[model samples]
Target: MFKYVYSLVFCIILGISPSFSQHTEEHAAATTAGHEEEKFDIGGMIMHHIADEHGWEFTHGVKLPLPIILYTADRGIEVFSSSRLDHGQVYNDYKNEHEHIVRVNADGTVNEAIHPMDFSITKNVATLMLGALLLILIFTSVSKGYVQNKGKAPKGIQSFLEPLIVYMRDEVVKPSIGKNYGKYFPYLLTLFFFIFINNLLGLLPGGANLTGNIAITLVLALITFLITNLSANKYYWKHILLPNTPKWMWVIMIPVEVVGVLMKPLSLMIRLFANITAGHIIMLSLFGLIFIFKSWAVAPAIGVFALFMSAIELLVAFLQAFIFTLLTSMYIGSAIEEHHAEEHH
Candidate 1:
């Protein structure tokens, strides 16, 4: 078991070492340009690190350009490599600016009049795909283990994930959704692990901000909202639409309840987006300390601070995933909750 774990650790490092070396070289190059004092553009650096891009940048000069797909009335569908944009330089009347791929006029300016629907597979999109693939591979392996080792002790990845899965089912789903929890076990499990894995992935250097993306969080929250409403019993709707209150209070109370229906998902969306984005910003800012100081003496202090934060981030990643899943389960529970009537003797 130890050997297997060590091998896995080694493979992960082997995968990341190339990017680390590339980043180191690039940082060195940037700092040693003819002995001139380099002014660190702190805001630019932070935003660049956090923002989505058309390419996956390993370092200064090393990037994997993804495909750019656009649709405009003039052009039915234009498919091309992102490299043609040349990192925001106009290409074939299209350009990428501030992560927004837009059409450019002949005179090298944004052509706002000509809007094109961008359907490009960007860095964040690529990372999302990677996360999905990893999730599939992991669950598939675990399922195979269950089939092959029936009635035997769990081993390998099964051992690692089984407890967590069971906890999610027993503690989270059961407590929240009660008797009907079985129906939502799969979705709750998937949501917990998917968010947890993506959160961890965002911690990696050169990693994509998958969960930090608003679109991703919005979709996740939307799904929760839909499920909550769709699974809602008539009793739940009665409480929302026609609360057991004074008839005179119905006018105000009903609106409040209606607003709450919308607020639940909105809160979920903002919570995930804000937490993930803040984590990235805080980490980047800490790393930026060395650049701001322009001195090697602060490197040790900054490194220590950053290391501490990274450790906290690991905990936070699991925590955020748990909170989201727990709240979702609670919402579903509320929706499907059954009311019992009192019996008089």
Candidate 2:
């Protein structure tokens, strides 16, 4: 994980070199001796791909426009295609800066005073919808196969996914969550497959960074946090609020336990975000190296390294989803666990 993070930082540094090269070009142009040159905007390129935008990038230069919905006190409500903005050219008192739509004044400067509420169907949101639809299609078909096949062997996608699902239920969920885990099995399984599928999709070129987005991870963790505490039995709260510790330690123990509740979700959020984002940044950085070196000779080497990293990321995708689901099961188990009278006594 640390190696992945280090690679990400190194890539960001490499990404900034384009701006440095541009500055050098400007300086050279001012001098007596100068030659024409092109500058690589590595930072911009990486950010453009990583950050959510109002349009889907289909290729290096092509983007499919999405609807732009904005609401302002003065304009009331404006609905139009994102293409109207023309990739930052013009829109209802707004302009695109670094793929971020910001309100602008008549003079074409940022209008800091009037920040319109943007409710655009961004690329990230669209990809989320797509992922959700795919999940529905897959599971729905698998369900029909189960009903129709009825006591027979699985087939088609069901055959492929059955072992993995069974492994998750038996190995990860049942053991960690204990008996009567059936109630939470569906939720855990859905969470695992949803995250795993999204992670894999993110690896595709021009795909949305759905799982890497902090907001998405935050929401996912929040669900686990709520489920853990909400399903907690009297025994669970008793351990935290009225632990086996002496009365004198209550002051420290209670607060510490309360903080621990919050920290679990926070850790979940950061772990998923950092791991997924670091993987992507590292991959992008490897691709950026070819432009940085300006040499075709190094292409094969970089491609091999990037390909190797991608394989690792593929494993990470499944690993992270499984870890997250397993931890969630453990938390749930701890909450709903029945404490024997002998143990408490």
**Alpha-carbon lDDT, every model:** 0.78, 0.77
Q: What is the TM-score of each candidate against the true structure?
A: 0.88, 0.88
TM-score of 1: 0.88
Minimum summed lDDT over a 10-residue window in model 1 is located at 1-10
Q: In candidate 2, what residue range of length 10 has the lowest lDDT sum? A: 1-10
C-alpha RMSD for every candidate: 5.1, 7.3
After best superposition, candidate 1 residue 36: deviation in angstroms?
7.3
TM-score, prediction 2: 0.88
lDDT of 1 by residue, 1-345 (tens): 111110011123222211121123223433344644446666777677777888888667778989999999998899998888874578788888877888888888888899999999998899889877777777777788788889999999878767777777788889999998878877877787778877777777677778988999999999999999999999899999988889999999999999999999999999989998888888777766766776778888877887777777777778889999999999999999988464111
Give the per-residue Cα lDDT of candidate 2 at 44: 66
For model 1, which pairs clash? none
